[model samples]
Target: MELTQRIKQRLREVEDWNVVRDELETEAASHADKSEQSRALYDLARACESVFLDKAHAMTCYQQAFKCDQSNLTALRHAREIYQEMAHLEMVARLMGLELARNTDASIQPSLSYDFGMAMLNQRKIDEAKSHLEAAQSLEPSNERYSDRFQEVLYDRGKWQLGLENVMVQLRALTGSDDPLGSDVVKRGHPLSALFLRAARILQQESPDDPKLLPCLFKSLDADPSNDEAGYLAETILGNGGHLQHVQKLQDRRIANTDAPEAKLALMLAAANVWHVRLNKPEMADYFYHQALDLAFNEAIVDVGWGSDWFLAAYRRLAQGADESGNADSLVPLAERGMSMLGEVDCSILALSAGELAWKKFKDVDTARRFFSRAAKLAPDHPQVVAFRRAEGLDDEAKTTKLPAMAPEAEVLTRELPVADDDDAVDVRVDETPRRSTFVDPASAAEPEPTRTPEVDAEPEASPEPEPEPEPEPEPEPELDVEVE
Candidate 1:
């Protein structure tokens, strides 16, 4: 192409710049003012620089252009863009600060605020980040992207050290966070039920009705089916073993899915608990108990507080079962293993329960008392231990008062009479005179005239003859008549 034609084409491409420049030049020449021409030249320069990808150069030109002509919208827009590109965020922030001060466009300020928030985020100024981000979000509520970013910042803030409420707030801001297996869901605390459910979901993918998942849910349900966290637990149990077997089929169809370690653990626990505590299937219980213990072993470091308890319980049960069946050798190692997992606090409770069980069921009072005493020492204020002590006292009292067995006749006599007076009652002598037993017709009886009865009455001879008595009443009547006269 010829040079002239190329120039023409270039000129045509920037027609707005040329036209504006020409008009400004004409006006300046007419007015004989160098300032207008200079300003026009600056505007032309800014227009040419707008094509440059170098944001810095474009920004400088735009600022110069605007100084020359304050009403330059192109310069204003280009300057804003360059301010946005300035990698020295502090400087970019200052420029935004200037824009905010001007308050030129209410709509643009919110966006500017959002950009500042992002800049703050890049600098890791969290408080400032949240402040600016929230301001931006408030102004432009329709911009979910900004809201999401703000919530993401909050989520990161609560990774470990922050309180659970803080973490949950951020989680709720994200959709579907209520579902454990949902993409944005984060487990902030020891929400065992949710954790179990998440594992179950993962397991479900492996085998729709994996028997593995059933036991996990069943144990939780049995322990407390009404627990909100255990909602899916029930479903998983049904899937694995309950009527429909729908989950099983789903799992069978997708058997290639991987088993989640957590889910497997949960399932094992559920199964073992049900088999041991519910169904009393020792073999089944042992199989899952060991599996659960193994899983707990892996999780101990991450979830030590509760995981340790679970592991210890499973190991203890398994060992006890083995020991009771004459497999003391196998039981020894398990007991040792569980003991290792036991923390001081938990050990106290376990010891106490063990002692009580031994005593109450087996009448090993000495052992039980030792256990109760240890438990009291472990938790002096524990209500249960205190109650146990009260019960122990009552039991002792009961034993002390236990009476000896008496002869059949004595037993019958003692039982027949309601105790009228405990102290007043006399113990019948072995060889006492025989007393005649008497009874009265309760309905037709009248009080007997107070009188002495003969010790022996043979046939009452004829109607009792009136007892002969001397009459001496006449003298007393004569003396009373004389006194009245």
Candidate 2:
């Protein structure tokens, strides 16, 4: 019997969809044509979905429908929707590809192609996504979303050079305007900064020292000076002499014009490099370094990988110079300031050095012990910390007792006793007598030896004169005189 005729007859026999559904299922089981079976299953799925609201049964029916007839658009659409919602992006992309192949009308091609491309993109199918997105953009050139998505795909595929070219095109359009800052591109999205940053990153990776990268970095900084990456790249380029004079001039101008803390900080840092490297002014260099450090603590300077290390090193140099000059007073303050700038963990070695200087030169055991203890807290088992602890008598084996001063006459003594010879058979008995203490009273002991002063010790020792030669032995000069005569 025809499946439709059976469904109709069953519908007339009973107004219940359950009866019609059961009859259709029986007929579908025995149906000869796969198409008829697919229709029956699809109808049953609709009935289950609309009447019973059973998504699982509807999904099963849709799958069966698609299996029976590959051309079943409705079934494919429903199944694809479910898969998409389930985040089965690969399956969604495949189904969309099939749908696109089925639909050939130009009116619907753009939407279908875009959907397929987005699905592929979600699945990380970059090449396929780019192809489809490009097609969609060409079909509808005015679609901003398509253009944006295509650009994203290009970037994802590591086509940074192409991305940079597109960015340059946009930048040119904006900069060509009478008021670039008020241009639509800037008002909509200052993609200029992001593009510059991306281009800079690509160039940096490809050839860090390339001259072209300097312009990109500078453009990025111009777009947004607060950009940490741009600042870092600019600093690196200028430091390496990439447009050094021009960048320094611009930085100086920006510093003079802008009161923004981040800008000032970056500019001051660059100025410091200029002073130290180009101008050869140590005083100005130190001044800028300190200014940058101060600004960093108070302001939100973007961390361009210059955090505390530079200042800490400068402080160390100063402290070391002072220590070498035997100016303990100056060394302590510098080291202490450095320790405060950098945490205890990073500056523990500085602390140890200061402790040693304090103890050895200043004889300030308390200060030395305090510094050592702080260092121990940071690195308990450090070699220097352990050595300092032991040297300061703070170790486990250290004794607390203090011995009294020795007496003046309590000196070391050496004596030898003679032994009897065994050759003579005679009695040789020697009496054993106890020795008396040789220590003398303090009042009777000679005056304590005077301590030697450096000036006195600096004097040269005196030496005896050389012996005079004998007059007769003074070479016979008379021999030559007699010959001349």
Candidate 3:
């Protein structure tokens, strides 16, 4: 053939390998005969591999060569090599599977089947991996690696089956179904739930605004509420207000269930979000927000295992609600309670809020200073903390005022009580007689009393002195007179 001669002549030329590859590719395109084209493409692929080291391009050429001639073992081997090096395990598995299917030779089938099985294992195609691996083991019972890989596949398959059983159980729980046969179907584990969740996640990542994703996410969550990814998708759904009726139905069901605190919290958060964002009813939103936070806090406190982190998250939601409602006054108490309840937890927002409220709303400079100082301690580099400190001149030293000293007379006077001694005692007597009248009645006060009293008193005054003692002794002798007296 002219093309083959031209290809040989071009290969012998002193031209660059790239030029030779281009000429061969041109020759390959020009040829109408499948055999000639296959030879030219194969040569071109070799040129690309040796000179350019472009395995991907060479693989393409080898694929074309194999399509032109199915008996092209070189093309198959080179393509398989390139795929293996690229870690295209799925492609290698497919290629080897096809080779095994086409080849009737038992010896070559065992090697190809083993390679296919290994590739399938790498691709996580466990069932196919198991089948081909078992076949290889049967063909060459002495191959330990094939047995090991097969055992691994069997172990993975068992785990996969168990996971599917769990998913089915969750599905039945969500749907409130009593189908006994559902377990049988999922006992071997179909990948439906995982596949659906994966697809939903892909949709969320690729086309978030696509209308179809909401239902997918909702289904994922409905199947398993414990799925954190599904929960996030639910949040996104709620945020967009995409399915209010369904959300409301879920909320109603969760609210009716008194025993499920976590479910109730989730529903409460959802309701709060709906009210705050969609309905624009901040008061109602605040009510639900507080309810959810209260529930979470109670659950955490009762050792229900809803850790302190959950309580802190609830507190943050409450704070967010307060902020959204424009209730700065509420933030004061919230910040205080948050600090007390979340001890040692970083509460910079609460501290900043408390400081701002103290400064602006309460107008208490000292309280504001204390709160701002706390905020600074918590987050010194926070913008609000820095701004507040700068605005209040906290970075500056305080000016001191001195008062003049008091004079001696201006000093405070203190009285001291005299102490009493045990031996020191005093007694005093008082007169009870009434005082004489200073004025006399002129008609009634005659002078007759003065003369008779002076006559009786004068005799005693003259006789008095020495005889008085003897006379007293003589009078003592008269017992009768003394007794009568």
Candidate 4:
């Protein structure tokens, strides 16, 4: 990387600035190796910034140097410092983010994440900051800088009271978040649900009857219904405090606030689980399962992963419910419909349960065999299926059950989905993880039929009493005659 003689003479003493700049630009553009090109660009940037005083052009040159060779951290660092000195924090963050995107080094990742989170927080980009700061703190939990920064965000936003400061100290030990009680958290509620959940878990353990336990727990859930474990814990809380009604309100509020079908489905499954297991209202669980399918089925048809995950959850939960549910006559078909739509999954539990119910309850051997075969197709080596296969004396090579595929061309799903209006029940998705899928329809009449707003009749309405109309006519005639007189 020796300099050319002509450039070397200029380096010893600048005779003409233009000639030195031109030679450097030429070298940067024509260098065959990226490292050499980056080196040339770095030198060019330095000359432009120091001598020509072209900060903008110098910034571009440094960026280009970094682009040419990421190993040139000096170039990026220079660019970042220049932007920072000029009070362009956003640009500084952008450069930091680029470095992070490469995942070039694990050692500096926490620092970069912490710095990036701070920049975003300063910009009032709470959601973006939430992940990065949380990650930085998690990665370097011992680092007070990272931990304090993240906790500060939650506290400033949470606006906790003095009485709660001790609680906060305890919570920070358990988990570094407050009640997440601000309008800001209310709007997006990130870390809101996570924090609320942590608090709920703590309360459940220490003060199961605390008035705030269920609210905090449900709020945590409504923020992210993806976790499904609220069932048993909720049962415990509700059973102790009997604040089931409060949970109901939260569930309705969450359903009304969110429009994402997946979110709605999560709520539905949560409620269904609560009703099926805790409240022992199997009918209600059946209703919610139907509602969840109606809400999420079409989404499953279209979405690749997330919405479909919710659908599968509702399906599997309903299928599990079907075993003990008094409304199995109706619930089983709804679960089957979801299984058919999913086409195939790694787990066959739903299909296996469906087969068991079909044989033991419905007494339909053929349909039961079909379901069993489908279950076998999903997991040919599953122990349960193997044991069942041996008992049934089925062939080793059972033909795969090919249920009707959720046809991509199936009638554009116009199903009226309808979660709750004014009910006061908390629905906690059971442990399958407020696990994610999107799922549909029941075969039995026990399923509540979709409500239809019938078209209004065009015919004029008749008087409740025709005789009353005649009396009014007589009275009007008598009044008219009196006026004429």
Q: Residue by residue across 134-155, what tens digits does model 4's lDDT show?
A: 9999999998557655664554
Q: Could you tell me how far off, in angstroms, the CA of residue 248 lies in candidate 2 after the best superposition?
A: 52
lDDT of 2 by residue, 58-121 (tens): 5677777777777776776776765543345566776786777776557868777777887876
Clashing pairs in 1: 207-251, 208-247, 208-250, 208-251, 209-247, 209-248, 215-270, 215-271, 216-267
User: Which is the better candidate, 1 or 3, if ranked by lDDT?
Assistant: 3
* True-structure RMSD, every candidate: 44.8, 38.8, 48.4, 29.6
Tell me the whole-model lDDT of each prediction, alpha carbons only. 0.40, 0.50, 0.47, 0.51
Query: Best candidate, TM-score-wise?
Result: 4
What does candidate 4 score on TM?
A: 0.33
Tens digits of lDDT, candidate 3, 390-422: 676654532221111111211221011121221
Worst 10 residues of 3 by lDDT: 476-485
Query: Model 1 segments beyond 4 Å from truth?
Result: 1-46, 49-56, 69-77, 155-485
User: TM-score rank, highest first?
Assistant: 4, 3, 2, 1
Error of 2 at 216 (Å): 24
Tell me each candidate's TM-score: 0.27, 0.28, 0.29, 0.33
Which 10 consecutive positions of candidate 4 have the poorest summed lDDT?
Answer: 476-485
- Model 2 bad stretches (over 4 Å): 1-33, 46-53, 101-107, 140-148, 154-485
> C-alpha displacement of 156 in model 4, angstroms?
10
